[model samples]
Every structure is written in C-alpha cells, then in structure tokens.
Target: MAIRVQLTERQAAAREEYESFTRQAVAPHADAWDRAERLPEEFLEEFAARGLLGAAVPAGYGGAELDPITFGLLNEELGRGCSSVRSLVTVHGMASYAVARWGGDRQREHWLPRFATGGAIGAFALTEPGAGSDVKALRTTARRTDDGFRLTGQKRWITFGQRADVYLLFARLDGREAAFLVPRDAPGLTVRPVTGMLGTKASMLAELSLVDCLVAPEALLGRPGFGLAAVAASALELGRYSVAWGCVGLAQACLDASLDHADRRETFGVRLRDHQLVQRMIADMATGTAAARLLCQQAGWLRQDRSTESLHATWLAKYHASRTAFRSASDAVQVHGAQGCGDGHPVQRYLRDAKVMEIIEGSTELQQTTIAESAYHSRTRTTPTERVTA
Candidate 1:
C-alpha cells in the first residue's frame, strides 16, 4: 500500500480528491447500501454530475476524459469505499469507450452527449444465461429488417441494467455477430430486476428481454461480424484494467480494516496485534495489497502507452489482484472473529463483494488461461533462431 504510482501534480491532486469524496460519500453508507440492495436515485445523479460515470468519454461530450492511470485511481478509491458504486463506474466507462471507438457518427452523436452529461446511464449487455464468458455464444439474435433490425433475446447478469438508460447489446445479426445501441424505452424491451446475489447486491442487476425489439439502422455500432473481435474486445480490455485497480483498492481497504481492528481489540489481556497469528495475517494482507497495486499500475502504464501488450498485462493484473482482494477480505473477517460475520460489519460485506470481483470482468480461471495463452502466442511469434539469440 505504500507503493505509489507516478502521477502529475494534477493527477495526484485528483487522487486525493477522489479519496476525500469516497471517505465522505461512500464508506459510511456502503454496508447499508449493500443491505438495501439499491442505491438511491439521487446518488446516481450526483455521481454523474461529478463526472465519475463518464470518466472515459471525450471532453467534448462533457466527460472528464481521464487517462488510464487517473481513471484507475478513481476506481481504486471508490472500490475501497464500496464496490457496488465502483461497478457503475466500470460498466459506464466500458459502454462509453465502446461508443467512442466503434459507433458511427449518428450513434455517437445520439448517445455520447447523454452519457457524458449524466442524462443517461449506460450498461453493457453481452452476457447471456449460457454465455457468461463466452461472448460468441450469445443467443440474442438481430434479424435484418426493412427499417433496421429485429432483436430478440435475453441478457442476464447485466450490471446497472435495472436503471440503465441505454444498453450496448450484442447479438447475431444476419448470422454474424453485431452490436446495437438499444434504448430502454424501445418497443418490446423488458427489464426484470435481479437481487440477492453472493455479492454486489447493490449493483442494481437485471435481466433484459428483447422480444422483437426494433432499432433504426443507426443503432448498429460497427459492421457485421466485428462485434466480438473489435467492440467487445476493446471494451473488455479496459474493463479488466479498471477491475484490477478496483481490486487493489478492495485489498487495501481490507488490510486497513484488519489493522484497525487488531489495534482496537484484545484477547486474553493482550492486544490482537500482539498475537503472532494476527500479525501474520496483517503482513500477508499488506504484501498482497502492495503487489496488486503495482501490477495494476503496470497495466495502466501499458494502457496509456497504447501498447498491444496492454491486454495481456491487464489479464495478469486482474488475475492476481482479484485473488489478493478475496484473500485479504477473508483474512479481515478472520481478524475480526465472530463480530466480522454480523450486521454493521464492513468486513462481511467486503468478503462478499470480493468474491464478485473474482467472477466479473473475467473470472480468475479465465484470466489465467488468457495470460498463459497470450504468453505462448508472443513467444511463438519469434523464430527459433531469434528465440535462442534472445
């Protein structure tokens, strides 16, 4: 946690500001929000007005347009306070990034301003009941029609779906994968709220049903067959980067909580921190948090460089950071003993939300494979002689 990522004075100031905001606006309410399973409508508006919801869009669109490192700081601090609030930032940025990169003029013009100005909340609707990590296996279909396309399918596990004003939905269009911008009020679209999750219960999750939903031709993002390879690929890459930083924040939070509890609690006439067992957990939590933060910063550097290697770096960061966050949360609960599992305890909530971090953006197992596969591919790109010379 002592390791700091190099930042400009402005960025450093921004990070401090984010920290102050989180301490004031998020930390105190996090547990209650989790129990309630929904954030107040006013909070969303304030979040958007503060430019957090549109952190990735261009300034012309009324967004803050933060760089990757700066954006990571924002996510990290917010994640430290409450992952459900951080979830909104991640998904909204993903959707904004997609439109900025892949959307046609009309699509961008129609959506980016609203998204950037807090006039709309955006969600990515790529996951299906059977296609959690398999983007290509989505069952949603968009049949080409005289006017535009007829969309019919279901999207499950959509974060902020219950309140999203727009969705960047993926479907098979004329037998090839495509992306479409579907407004919430589109004809034949239904949103069903989902609750009682293992974690992130306050994320406002929902299942979207598009029964013959219709969008004009302008709704299409890129050309047919480019959905998964380009739009979704780009979005998910940024997503991994954001989630990795968020996990770093979560880990740090757990470590801080554990440290405070050990200092304040005693057993058998000795402070908890005086016990070797508690000290060991604290040491592990601190080390893991530092390592995860470093990895996330490395990925952020690659992202800012616009390097091709950024994607794999993100895989590595996400894989390690998520595991560290979960492990840290588990130890935090252990340090608190029975009290940690009860109501009004933040550690209990952290434990649950950390589990969701390991699952979303990409599961821990999924990231391991992606990193290994990418490593082999990079190695194979060099000839045998070049490899040996290297």
Candidate 2:
C-alpha cells in the first residue's frame, strides 16, 4: 500500500535535500563516529551549512520555519544514515522548539539565531537519577534570590550534555517546577561524560551537577509553576515525532539489509529469499513500517492543524513505532546471522539504536499507560447524554 500523506513541493524538495546531505556526509562517517564515540565538530558545521539544524524554528529567528512534519522527514532520512545524527536532530530541534514556543523576547533574541546557525548547542536537562518518568519526583531545586535564582541539582542521561553550550535546566522553585537556562561556563556547574550506550555512540551523554548555580531572572523559561508541564508537552511532542520517523528509517534499513542478505545467501541450493519464513519476516516488517509511518504522519498533521487529539496521536505514534523498529532491527540481525553480530555492521548498530529509542523520550510502558489512562478518562468524562444506554 502506498503512503498517503500529501507533501508540498517545498517539503518534497527539503526531504530530498536532507537525503542528499545524509548520503554525502553522515553516511560516510557513521563507522568512524561509532568507533570514536564522538561527533565530529565539522559535521555540526556541515549540518548548519545545509540549514538542517533548527529547521523548525521561526523565520524571524533565522530558521527555515518548516513544520514539524518536515523536520520529521529530515530526521528519518538522517536516521537512515546514522542514528546519532538523528539524535542530534532530535535534541537540538526539541530544545530550540521549546525556546521558540514558550521563551520570552530576551530568550528568543539570545538563543534562536545561534541555534539556527549551530553556534550554540542546547541540551534539555530534566532527567535525574531519582526521577525518570515521574516529574514530581524531581529533586533539583532552585532558590529565589534578590538578583535571580540559585539552582542546585544533578541531571543525568542528558543527551549532548557534555557538548551543550547552554542547558534548558529544569529545577524546583519554591516546591514548584521551573526551568532556567544555564550556560556551560556558569559557576558551580559541572558536566561529566557518560559512556557505554548501546547506540547513538556519537552523542555525548553526560551527568550535570549544579551547586548554587546562579541564574538571572531573564534565564527562566515560561512561568515558574508551568515548567514541568511545558517541557513535558514540548519534549513528548518532539520525541514522538522524531522517534516515529526514526523507526520508519530503521525499518527501511532493516528491510534493505535483510533483502540483500537473503538474495545473496543460499540455503539447500536456493536463496534465503525463497524460504517462506524469510518472506514472512519481510512482509511483517513492511506492514509494521507502513502502519507506523502513517500514524506518525497523522500525528504531525494534527499538530500542524492545532488539533486537541495531537497529544494522544503522538503517544500512539511513539509507542507503535518504537516497537516496530525494535522488532524489525532484531529480525534483520537474525536474518544476517553471524555477520550481523560482527562489529561495524549497520544492522548491529541499528539493533542497538532501536533499543534506545524505546527507552528515551518516554518508555514503551509509559506510553502504554498514557494511552490507557487517556482512554479511561475520555470514557469517564463523557456526558450522560453522550453515554450509550447499553
């Protein structure tokens, strides 16, 4: 079945340009980056040169002003080349989007142009050692001062943490959640690099500690009590959109790898493609990919339309696509047999990368719970007249 999302000519061109950039730049460096476990500085500049970074930011802020769906398309293409590159897209785009949407004039003037040009790397610091899914469990605190706020807390598993020039740091202010912009050179701030990630090797995951990190009043994002809600809504929207598209790319990669291996490998004097089980795997992969892609695109369209159902659709897309990507990557690895487990193979990387997708942004179990709770609330909140008399 053909995918039915309508793409404007401009969007189509953007996608093609993204694909071309990935093929020429990111794809060629995947192995080297994985081996080094560091993203090359030059690559970031290349992304900026291509106008790929901060593509979703408004034109007034020096961005392309593209919609989220277009950004997703770009992410999918980048993921097809390398998951790390896709992750960079997610983190940068998400942080920039948050700033653009909720940031005040000063915040916009300070970060937007730098982000669009890749001059400033932004990281979202929300996940703490003690708090994963529960935002209320966050222990990071900020005390209001005469001049500004003094922040103290630790943020772990922060993507681009070590390399971020500025952090969108979330902390508790007077027992309420608040977010502040902390520069890397801020006093009493430290970032330590974390290792041993299954995928996204090039991304510099780190743990950040802030001991009386002073932030000016102008550094606050949105309102004091609304930080958690604002960040949650923004992050989940971007996470789901990016992950959904990344899953589609992963599925496509898996399909291509499996097909290639099956066509070349022989079993009992026949190609592996001739086997019924092999064909079934390919069919399943294709079906799952199509379903996930459609859900993702639908969510994106809803977001563009400013529909209330966008959040529900976003959760659905993330949950479904993460599962699909994991399954497809695992199956692809199985299809490749011993060769798949070998170091430096794209399938192995895909398998690792796919697993991380399930955990980041929000876990699969978390999304499932969100979906179920949403359904339950919807049913309970229905008007008596609207309720069926079964």
Candidate 3:
C-alpha cells in the first residue's frame, strides 16, 4: 500500500533513495544472509559508505541528522528487505542516540564520530539472566574504586555484543542504576554468541560476562541513578517505532506473496484466486496491512511531534501491528499450501520472522499491560488543585 500521509519533499526524496538502495543492495542478499546466519562485514562497510548506518546522528558528529520519522521510514524500507538488517539499525541508532542525549561533551566528542562512521560498533547491555523486563531487579554492579569503578555481572541477549567496539553497559552503582561505556577490549570482559533464534539470524546475539572489569570515571554516561530510566525512555520509543514499521512491512510482504500464489495456483478446475474463500483471505490480509501501516505512521508522527500521547500511541501501534503481521503471515502460508512449509519458499521465512516480532523487543503481553496501565492512570489522575479540593 502507498503511504497516505503528507511528506516533505526532502523526506520523499530520502525515502525514494532508501527504497532504491534496499531493493538493489539489500533485498537480493537477504536469503543468503539468512542461510549463512551472519551479516556480511561487506554489508556493514557498504552501509557506512552510503551513510545509512548512522543516518540519524547529528551532522556535527558525522551523521545525517535526519528526523526520527525519516529514520522510521528508512527502517521500514530496510525491514521490507531483511528484518535482521533493520535490527542492526535499531540497536546502533539507539546506542548513539542514548549517548548524544545523555553523554557529556567530552564523551560525545570522543565517541560520536567513530560510532557514526562505523569505525566503532555500539551495543547496549542491559538484559540479564535474572532480569529481563524488570530494570530494578538487575544484578550487575559497579563498585567505586580509587580512580574509577569495577564492574561485574552477566548481560544476556545483547545484540551485536560479540563484535561491538563499545558497549553501553548498565549496572548498579551504590544502589543506583548507571550506564558505562565499556570497551570490548576491557580486561576480564567475555562475549559468547547465542544461536537458534527463530529469526533475525543475520544479527548477532551474545551473552556478556564482566569479571571485575575496570571502567574509568569518564566511562559513565549521564549522571548516576538515571541509566535505567534514560535507556528505557529512549529505547522504548525507538524500539516501538522501528518494530511497528517492521510489522507493517512484514504484513505487506505476506499480502503480496499470498496474492501472487492465489492468482497463479490452480485447483481441480480453476485458479485459487477464483475461489470465494481465497478472496476472503486476501481481503483480510489487505485490510490488516492497511490498518497496521496507518497505526504505525500515526505513532511515528506522534513521536516526531513529541505529543503527550506518544507513549501510549507507540505501544498501541506496536501491539496491533505485531499481531496483524503474525496473522497475515500465517494466512500467507496457508494460501501457499505445502510449498509454504519448504525451506526454498520465502513465505515460511516470513512466518518465522513474524513470530519472532511478537516476542522480541517487548512481548505482546507486555505491550498490553503497558497500555492498560497508562490508560488506567490517565483516567484516575487528578490535578493538584482537584486533589486538594476533594
């Protein structure tokens, strides 16, 4: 489906450029990357050279400084080709944005250029064995030392962890959350790859072990006691936007595949597209795709404008789009019959990828709880004057 919202000429041009690049350079390699279970280093170099790797970083820091909505559009186009590639953008952008927003001038001057140029890869280390969604429950700790801090903990499910040059690692400092920029070469640091993920094989996932790793005072990002909140505020908004767009892309792909299969496949006497049930399924897919795209775009716009409802809108978009993607992909597979189950067919891959979208970043159940809580609080809250009067 075509985008319906108004776009600035520059945004339109950027989208066109991104779409062309993805179709030519990214889409053709998706199947091979999936089969290999690794993102090609060449792809990274190419992305950097094209300024796609750090498109959202500020211009002074060697980035394109594109607005968040444009970044979201770029992500959607890339996701249409390969979700794994889009995952790279999500993690990298999140790390860079976190530093830019909270890092000291010295930190920004030292790190932003390398990060934007792809001379350094950044990974956020937050998830742990004992703590997935509960930030306060994290066990990683950093103790004060003579000139710095000593960190010790295990971080799990870190994207790009194995090869990242720097890490935005989160740990507790004096009973408060803090973020540190831990170099990959930091002494006593170890990274182990995790395998068998259902999708996004091209993006590496690793477990990190920090055994008394030392970080200088300069390594700390922002003020102490704000790491968890900062990361959550930034990552959630960006993650929700990226994944919601991704789900729209997945739904569109499913709809296209299902339509192609239905139009060509023949039954006992006629083509599958001629059947009433097949038509109904295609109609459902199209409707879902349109709805998902609209919701995603609305969220993106709200985020770009920094609207008061941005948080709730983002959660709503992500929750609905992910469910729509999964349902559409499943229907696409059914439309393809046995061929959809084969490794050679793309529909099966879409199905697998769509299922992964439902679980990663934040689960559907989590989104539901967030939305409900937000709505509940919004309904019950009163102004200070109202409370006093009551």
Candidate 4:
C-alpha cells in the first residue's frame, strides 16, 4: 500500500477541525432531524455564521474563501454528520456559484452578501416534473414583459425548496434557455412541501409552481441561451465534486458503524467480526471507502487546476463514491442485524441516504454513459507513445 497522494498539514488540520465540530454538533442529531422531516433554521444560521455554508463565497463577500479541496473537506465532514445538512450546503453552493460566476453586478452585490451571512438561503431549480436527468426536455416558459419577465412553469424535487429564500431557476425564452433569480416572495409562485422521502428527510424538498411569476429584468443570471450550457453546467460541476466527496464521507461513516457493531455484537458465541462472511464484508467496505476517497481527492485536485479533464474525473469520482456508499451502508445494516432495521437506528437512515446518493448529481447509469463516451474520445486523442504497458 504505497501512498499515491498526501494531504498537506494544513489540509489535515482543517479536515480534523470540521470533523470535530460535526461529531459534536451535527452527528448526534442526524437521525432525529431525519425523523422530524425538518432542519432547524437556527442550526442553518449557526452553520452560516461559522462560514461553513459559504465555501464558494469570496473574502470580499465576508466568507471563508476556501479552496476546492478545503471545500470538499467541509462537505465530507457535513455528510459524515448528516447528509441533509450536506445537501443544503451543496444546493446553496450551486446557486451562490452561479451568481458569483455569471450574475450581473447588482445581483452579485445583493445576493453574495446575503448568501454568505445566511440572510437568504438559496436553492437550485432544474429538475422539473417531466424533466430530470434531461434538462433539454424542460417545459418551463419565460415570457418577456415590458417591465420584467413572466415565468410560468412547475419545478419538482427542489431541495430546501420549502425554506429557500431564492431560487436559481431556468426557463425557455423564445427557444433559448435562460437562468433567473426568483425570490421566494415572488407573486404567483407557490411552494408545496414534499414529505416521506426515502432519504435526506430534513432537506425540506418541495415542488414549486410558478404561474406568471414576475421578476425584474435584472433577474436573468446571464444572457439568453446561457442557462443550461453555461450557468447550470458550471454549478453542476461544483455539485458533482461536492457530492463525490460527500459520498466518501457517507461510506466512511458506514464503515465505522459496521466495525463498531461487529466488534461488540456476538453471535454463535463469537463476535460478528469472527465470522468469515462478516470479515469479507468489512474488508470490502474498507477498501471501497479508500478507493472512493482517492477518487474524490483526484477530482478535487483536477478541479483546483481548472483542467478540462476534471469533468470526467468528477463524474468518475461521483459514480464510484456513490456506489461505495450504497454498498457500505447495506453491509453496515447486515452487521447490525435487527438493531440496524429498527427505527431511529443511524444505519437504516444511512442505507436510505446512500441509495439516494446513487441517483442525484447525475445517476449511476448516466455517469456510465458519459464516462464511456469520454474514454472513447480520450483514447483516440492520446498519442501511441503516451501508452505504456504496466
């Protein structure tokens, strides 16, 4: 087991700090929050005040201004504690990053500060009732009005939708897709809460109905046609990276829980770990977690370099890490046996959340297609000299 990469001392320290805080504050309440189907506003406010929620915000905006790896570290720790909290941060980053990268001056000045300080919570609205995993099929309409734009459409599966103060929404305007910043208070917009979700129960997911919702002309995030290809893609790139790291955290959590259960629980007059089958499962969980972490680290560094190859790297990381989480969580439940199946057990929640991870930020099936296509093109582009046999 040679080391392929190493974290700097500063990075290690930062990760430890985040882990410590999450263990004390967030992890203890994850299951309870999930059962309640809501996350406390005060908890999110505290997170924002600590600058954990504003990883993408710059120093000028009164934020922590963390780098990609550090940002990933923050997300990882949060996921380890509670994925619902992590999802909130991920969705908020999508909205905040969009504004920072493409928003007009006024949009930036108004939104970034609020986003950093938690004066406003943000959510991304791209998944519509008929159009998820495929943004081109979106039917949301953006009609031009003299005073502003009139948006009419329904968005579904919006995380933090019930509580988000603003949404980074998308609509088709004259055959061109565009992005907009629609405040929660916008007239003709209605929010319908979605409960009984299989995972991330505290995420406050909701459906949004916009019936001729009017917004200022400045609401457009970028010029016409920049919605999917530019702004949404940019935000989703960060999202994939964040999700990849978060999955690593979830897998690790599963591994830790499984190990503890196996060590203490005795069956057939022996500890669970004494069984060969149980040992094999633990081995798989441990190795899978390590692989996921390695992939996430690779993705994080590529993101830091702003490399074109980073896109596929992120997809690869996300695909692998999410599966790792699902598998590990399943094994954790098996190790815990009856205890794991019981309500209020963290492993049960972990399994459910891990399944959800496989679907979001691009499903496992979608990533496979995209990665395969990228690999084919990459092999064709590489010089023969660059290929070496092991």
Candidate 5:
C-alpha cells in the first residue's frame, strides 16, 4: 500500500524522481552489492549524474541544493533499495555539511565543489577505538608544526574510510578538540578495510591510522576548540534525522516484501494471506512501517523550519523507526520461514542490516537517555514557570 503523507508540489516531484531513479538504477543491483560486500565505484558517478550525491549541498557549489524534506525523501528511496547505499549518503552528507557549515571560505570553495561532483569522496572520522560515543575521550592529537599540523591518531568504524578521497577527522589541539580535513594520500596515513561486519557489509568501513599525518594550516575546520561541539550540534543532529528516514524506508521495504510473500505462498488449505496468523504478522509489519514513516515526516518538517524542538523530534523518530525496522525485519523472516534464512533471499540480508541500524549514529540506549534528559529538563523548567504564573 502507498503511504499518504502530504507533500508540496516540489517535494512530491523530487520524491517521485528519486523513486523512479532508484527503481531503475539501484533495485536490480542491491542484492549483488550485498553479496559482493562492496558497492561498485561506478555507482558513485551514477549518483552524481542523477544529482543525488549532494542533496543537501548548495547549488552555488554545484550540488542539488535540495530542501530538507526532499533530502529525506532521497535517503528514504535509497534505503528502500539498500541500506548500504543509504549509508553512503549519511557519511558523505555529514562530511559535506561539516565543511559547508564550519570551513572557511577558501576551504568551502575548494572541497564542496569536489564533493558535489564526486571528484572527492568524503567520510566523517570522529569515532575512535576508545571513543565511540565519547568524543572527549579521543586520543588523536594534532601538534603544531612550523607550517601547519601533524596529526597522530587511530579512528575505527569509519564508513568509506579506505576509498574516500578526504576525511573530516577530529583530534586534540593544545588540549582542545579540533576538526581537520585530511587527504587520503597524506604521508603516514593508512586506511585498512575492517572485515567481518554484522550489517552494512558493503558500506566499506575502515580503520584509519594517522601517524604524523601532515596537513596545511588551512586544513583546520572552524576555529580550534569548537569542532567537537559543532559536530554534535549540527552534523550529528542531521545524521540522526537522516537515519530515521532511512529506517522508515527499511521498515517499508520489509513490509512490502513480507506482504508479497504472504499473498502468493500457500500452505495447508489456502494462500498464506488467508491464514489468520499470517494476517496478524502482515498487519503488524504494515502498522509499524507506517508509524515509523509518520514520525520521520514529522521530524523532517521540524527540521525544515529549524525549530528548537527538532532535536527531540529527531531523537524520537530515530529511536522509534530503528526499533520498528528491526522488529519488522525479524517478523518478515518468520513469515517467510525457511525460505527467509537462505543465503540468496533478501530477507536474510535485511535481517543483518536491521541490527546495525540500532547501533550506528547512536545506539538505542543512547537515544532513550537523550530523550529522557530532554523531557526531564523541559518538565522541570515548565513546572517552576507555571507555579510562579499561578
């Protein structure tokens, strides 16, 4: 069944274009990409050709310059085709947003155009071995040099780390956290593939070792001592929102796949869809998928206006959508029974991909804590104000 969310004419057109593009360019090869454990490099060019590579970037920089709703739709459509492909947008957009938001004019002029055209692939590298969620605990260091900075650190779980032409790397400078734009070919820099993933196997995650990696003085993004907070405020917020929409697509995909199987496959006396138990599973999948999509749409609207409540809205959306996607995928496997467990079946891939969604960007536990803290503060603040007014 088609979703009924309202959209403006522009957003509707953009969404339709994305859907048509993914159906033709992505759906057919999604399984092959998963099985190969890699997204073909050629697809990046295809994304550039379709103007999906830079959905959030400004057109002045040669990007599509889409609005937040349209950007969310792009990710949703890509997510429906494959989670791995959606991840490409997540990391790349994170890097692009970082540069566009924090970089100096010279920096922006140099990198944004390249990112827009697929001339330079970008990856955000803030997660370290000891600092997955805790950015303050990062051991990466950037020491001042006569000409610039020499960075030394190791970053783990960096998506597209090996293949990316540039990385938005975080490190400590003079005891303050800072962000740097590091080129892949910098001396002493090493990007190694991290094999054996639970999901998103084709996202091309890597472990980066920066041993005295040198960068020019102009490579610093934003002023020193502000990088971590800037990333948390902007890049991470955008990331959670994007992930929520992607999860919506994931759940929707599970629902569509499950419904198709239930309608056709038969057992005992009639079609599987005729069985009451099968109908219950189908209903649950459909409801969860729709609910997740609605939450994501609400969050997308809040983001469009840059509302103060957008952060909490995004947290709620991501938390609910990711959990729903996982549950739906699990139930989908149950609906398909033995057929779902086979290597070639799409459900088997969906099962693996769903679990990773819970952990990436932010874990489920993290989202719960964030939501609770926001609610607690809001209630406490309002209580005192109401008492005084009364």
Candidate 6:
C-alpha cells in the first residue's frame, strides 16, 4: 500500500519555487560538475542568495525558517537536480540547526548569520578511520587548557570538509565526549580532499586533521559530555530526513529519465514504452518513487513532535527510501541499456549516488539493527493490563 502527503498552499508554492530554481541553476550544470568532480564555491553563494542555504534557521538569523514539509520538498527538488547539491544543503542545514539547538547565545550570535548567508560554510566531523558506526570507538581527544581547550584528532569522510569555514567537531574530553566549534583556519588544522569518490563526487569530501587545535572555553556547545549520541541526536535525525527526501528525488529522477527515454527510443520496430518488459520497469520505478516520497513526508510530519516514535519513523523512512533509490536507479540503467552506461549519462550518476546514500548518515545494516530493536522492544513490552490479557 502507498500513502499520500497533503501539502499546504504555502508548502506547495515553496516546492514549486525550489523545483524551478533547481531546473534553472543546478540541473543544467550537474553533469559538468560531476565530470569536473567539484562544484564551484560560487554555486553555494547562489544557493544562499535564493534563501536555500538555511531552510530551518530562524528569520532573525537571516534564514528562511521554512517549515519541515517545505524543507523536505526543498531537498527533494535539489536531489532531482543532483545528489551533490542535495548533500550540501543537508550538511549546511544540519550545522545551522545544531547551533540553534545546542550552542550558547554567544555562539549563535557569532555563527548563525554567517551560516544562513553562506558567509561561512559548516562541516560536521564525527567519523574517524577507526570508528564509523561505533561512536564510542572515536579516539579524538579534547584536553582542557588554561586558556580554553586543545583538540587533537583525525576525522575522515567529512562532507564539505575542504570548503567549510568552520567545523562542528566531536571529541572526547576528560574521558567524556563533547562538541567543539573549530574554525577552518585554526592553528594546527588541515583538510585535504578525498579524490575520486564513487558517488557524490562533487561534494568535496575530505579528511580533517587537528593537532592541538585550540578554542576558547565558550566554543564548547551544550553541556559537558554532550557529544556522539547526545549532541548529535537531533542533527542525525535531520540528516536522515534530508537523505530520505533526496532518495525520493533520485527515484523520481530515474522514473522521469526512463519515461522520457522510453517514449523517444525505438526498438524492434516499436517505441521502447510499447514493450511489455519496459513498461513493467517503468511502472516499478514510478511506484517506488511515489512510495518513497510518501514515506519521506510521513517522517517529516512526525519530526515536528520530536518524540521517540518520530525517531523510529525517520529511520524507517531512510531505510526504505535508500533501498528504493538503488532499485529505481538500477532499473533506469537497464532501461537505457548502453546509453545509461556512458560517462555523461545522468542515470549513471544516479546509480552511483544511490549506492552512497545507503552508507552515509547511517549504513543500511545499522538502520536494520536499530529499527528491529525498536520494533522488538515495542512488541514484546507488556503493560499491566496487556500482561493480564496475555
């Protein structure tokens, strides 16, 4: 069964605005950007100019402050243009929201305006070579100094690492975890791009190195020991939501591309769309795209309450959307046959990007574990009356 989302008039308008912008600004240039393996920094400024950089940030801070549904639509539209562009919005939104939620007033005053306006791009650093899914295994350390604190660590797979003006870095301090706002030009810090990625090639992924990176005590966000699962909880939820919507967009892109190809391309003296097998593939792609979109909308709606149930819904949304994107991209390639395999084909990029979506934020394997654990606990737990009934 499939679900449908009922959008407000305002949300509908917002969605159209974003879709038009993507068609005009991003879609035309996506293939070239992918080939170049880099999106020019000027593009980010353009996004900011259009109020797409900080969708969730408050108006007072120079943000659009769009509601959750509108924000999800924005991601979906951008994803249709290219996953690389969607990735930038996801990371930027994550950092902006995190600061608003956990940073001190001074920190917010200092960073939000810049982040909202694209004056300072933000990167989140958590994953390390030794630790990817296992947050506890992270070895980055933050030592308290008389002046403030000194951070020493190496972070890998950080999106936008090479271009970010600041990093919301996670590290352990005095055997407890915490978050620090580390500037890009901080002393003893380095960011080097990870060349030749399999997907999101133009996202500017990089490795971050910090040796005795120092910051004022006020740079610490939230309470002590607020890192990993604690400080990152809200950010992770937002990331998953954004990724889910992006997947929906990817699936839709695949369906649209497949349909267009089928209508125009001929085989065996008939149009490709006239073939029974090709029709099946197109049907599946369209169905999956619609289903994935509904699931994303469900998660976006649940997010407003910020309840435990909402978290589970987001996980399920991400899991389903990622899988659907991969399937749709594969079918799209098959439909295109040789055309899809070419370097310049958009379907090829979609296939590569869909694979990466499954691994980022949280792997498909990790999502399975979390979702099942939650499901099992919910089913097995017995209330007083339920226990008697059983």
- For candidate 1, give the lDDT of residue 102: 85
TM-score of each: 0.96, 0.94, 0.92, 0.97, 0.95, 0.95
Better of 1 and 5 by TM-score: 1
What C-alpha lDDT do the candidate models reach, one value each? 0.90, 0.85, 0.83, 0.90, 0.86, 0.88
- Consecutive 10-residue window with the lowest summed lDDT within model 6: 222-231
Give one digit per residue, the lDDT tens place, for model 3 in 214-324. 888899887677555866567656766788888887788789889899989999899999999989889998998888778777777776777777777778888988898
Candidate 4 lDDT by residue in tens digits, 161-274 = 999999999999888988999999999899999999999999999999999999989998887785457898999988888888899899999999988989998999999999
The predictions' CA RMSDs to the true structure, in order, are: 2.5, 2.7, 4.0, 1.8, 3.1, 2.5
| Predicted structure with the largest TM-score when compared to the true one | 4
Give the worst 10-residue stretch by lDDT in candidate 3: 1-10
Ranking by lDDT: 4, 1, 6, 5, 2, 3
Task: Estimate, for each residue in 257-296, the C-alpha lDDT of model 2 and write its tens digit.
Answer: 8999999999899999999998998888889988988888
After superposition, candidate 5 runs with Cα above 4 Å error: 1-5, 381-390
* Poorly placed runs, candidate 1 (over 4 Å): 1-4, 378-390
What is candidate 5's lDDT per residue for 210-250, written digit by digit as tens? 99999999988887676468764688877888888888888
Pairs that clash in candidate 1? none
lDDT at 190, model 4: 98
**lDDT value for candidate 2?**
0.85
Question: How much is the lDDT of residue 223 in candidate 3?
Answer: 68
Over 4 Å off, model 6: 1-4, 226-228, 381-390
Can you list the residue pairs that collide in candidate 5? none
- TM-score of candidate 2 against the unseen true structure: 0.94
Tens-place lDDT digits, model 6, residues 190-286? 8898879999898989999889988888878876564445668888788889999999999899999999999999999999999999999999888
